[model samples]
Target: MVDVYWRIGMHGDQSTLRRRAETRGDWAPLAPGHLAPGWGDGHGDGRPYLEHMADVARAAEISGFVGGLMPSFPFTDDPFAAAASLVEETRTFRFMVAFQPGFVHPWGAARLSAALQQLSGGRLVYNVITGGGGPAQRWWGDEVEHDRRYARTAEFLDLLRRSWAPRPQSADGEFYRLADAYLPTDLADQPFPEIYFSGSSPAAIAAAGPFADYYLSWLEPHTALTEKFTAVRAASQALGRTPRFAVRIDIVSRDTEAEAWEVVRDGFSGVDLTALAEGRDGDSVGVARARSFIDGPVRDVRDLEVEPHVWGGFSLLRGGPSFGLVGSHEQVAERLNGLVDAGVDAFILAGVPHLEEAFRVGDFVLPRLTHHSPQGALS
Candidate 1:
């Protein structure tokens, strides 16, 4: 049976939005500014983001989510700093931090990972993000070519392993070099934290082959997913490793299928098609791949629905992980079970009104899944 892991994608809510939503005692809000300018609550206000992450981590624990995924960007709070703060405030919930190769050296990242693991009592997980947007890369003083990013990523992970290895260690890779240096001798019995990466590009999969513990991706149709996994598995096999699979989805669960679709309908009622088109056309390789799939072979995203309960609306609007298995609790479970039929082992799902939707899914649907398969059903 596959273990069902749940995490919330708490991408920032604007400041005004945060103020309104914070009325709930259980709600804690995070804003922009902790990382870079031009993001978060105030439009370009230089407010720090640590407050938001700390608040969200507290709320996630209250909401029954196992952890919070801190998105990495020049425009967001530094994930390592944010995680350190949150770990002190919470006891159980985990902190998953995203990092890109170009932004931080592997040794520096490994050091941060070890410190957080010790400070948090093993509640830290690393989200290994290969560089994505061309513009974003330029902002970092790096004009990395698309495919080369993944190659660097592979080298980065190799360096990390060497840096954090058990004893005296050294490694030389195409992108990095280390001398006869070993990690601090005090750190023992330190398990390598879970590594998660997302991309549809072939180079991305090949790069992730040896190191990633969990291959995360944007939700795709069942048929398309089967093919994607086939390639991923083959790549891992070529490296003589076995990696688990996970997905990020935006779910809308209601009492009935019709009600669920209505929630989706109302959510998108204000979405400007023109703006969405403009954003989609914006140059992000991840978005480009997603857009290509939607417009290319998979012309209409609706056609990619593997079951009645599953819908690819989010994928259409956003890039990477966009598809949500929307419907009644039972219907949603059935669709999720289908992924188990293929080889998916974990799901990281979220919704628009995150806190409330999490309650609905956790209280209602999670129990059914637990009852049906106490040890995790998707075997």
Candidate 2:
């Protein structure tokens, strides 16, 4: 049985509306030598920060989602701070907090993870992000090359695992060096939070193969996903470890297939071709893969039908987790079942206007899926 998770938007923007605004040229274009336009100034359609986070957290918890993934980005609210605040608002729901290794020392990461695990009663899961491109990396003053960043992340994870040991730990690496580094209190009694790693580059797979408890990827076709699974499995097998596999995707489910397609059409109506073309100028492998779908046979929004209920129109505008599943409740379930059959052990799903979509999928789609019980909340 594959576990399902939802994304909590930490950027403080109504995703659909924000995209719509961009399409209508409501925001300014990039200035000379600028990489991207400024976003999330709280000017577009979005709930107040506190209200939005609280509403989404409660909705995800009550909807039987296993957890909610809080993304980390230079343009958005700090995920660590957001998760800490959300902990006091919800009960029994886990948080997958995304973080980049280079932004914080290994000791600091370990301590924060331990503290969150204790505070949440073992409900913290760390999503290690090595970042995507040079532009975003430069924002954090990280000048390391792509492959070296993965190497640093591997060392970071190694030290973090050791820091959670019953006793003090020490490590000396090319990127980081620590002596007698340990948490203030022993975290051995409490289980360490699971580590979820995501990357599509070779260095990324090599780094995560021996460490990550789960390997996550943005949504790709089944054949592409199968190849990725094979590569990761081989890497893990070489290290005598078998890590779980997961994917992040968007969903648009309604009572009928036509209704679901209608939602997609409306969302696609806001597409900004100019912005989409500019966003593809990045060097991120994930971004390139996503843009590939848009540049391929998917000429128009209606041509985004990739596989069965899978839709690629989201890829035309969004960078990460661009693929969306659009269909009736049963059809969505069927699409998910196919991915699960293709070796996906978990799913991180989201939709526009997150709160409403959370309940819609929770009420209509989850109950129809096999290997899932909607009777109780996630433990």
Best by lDDT: 2
Report lDDT (Cα) of residue 344, candidate 2: 80
Candidate 1, 1-379: lDDT as tens digits: 5544444333344221112232221123323432322344554454344454455566557656677666676555467777786788999877778788877777777777887777778888878887666566788777778788889998888888778855766677777777664567544356668888777789999998998898987776556667778889999998899988987766767788787766556545544444324444223555654444444233343453545656655633332254677788877776666566566777676664445555667676665553243233222
Give the Cα error of residue 308 in candidate 1, in Å. Answer: 2.2
Model 2 weakest lDDT span, ten residues long: 30-39
Question: How accurate locally, in lDDT, is each candidate?
Answer: 0.64, 0.75
Which digits, one per residue and each the tens of the lDDT, describe model 2 over residues 1-379? 6778888876643445225432211223423321122235434433335566778889988998888999988877788898888887789888999999998888888787787888889888889989876677788899898889899999988887887765778788899888888876555566788888999888999999978888998887666777888999999999999989988988888889898887677767767645455554345777677666654544466676767776766655454466778888888887777677666888898876677778887888777768643331111
The estimated TM-scores of all candidates read: 0.80, 0.87
In candidate 1, position 250 carries an lDDT of: 67
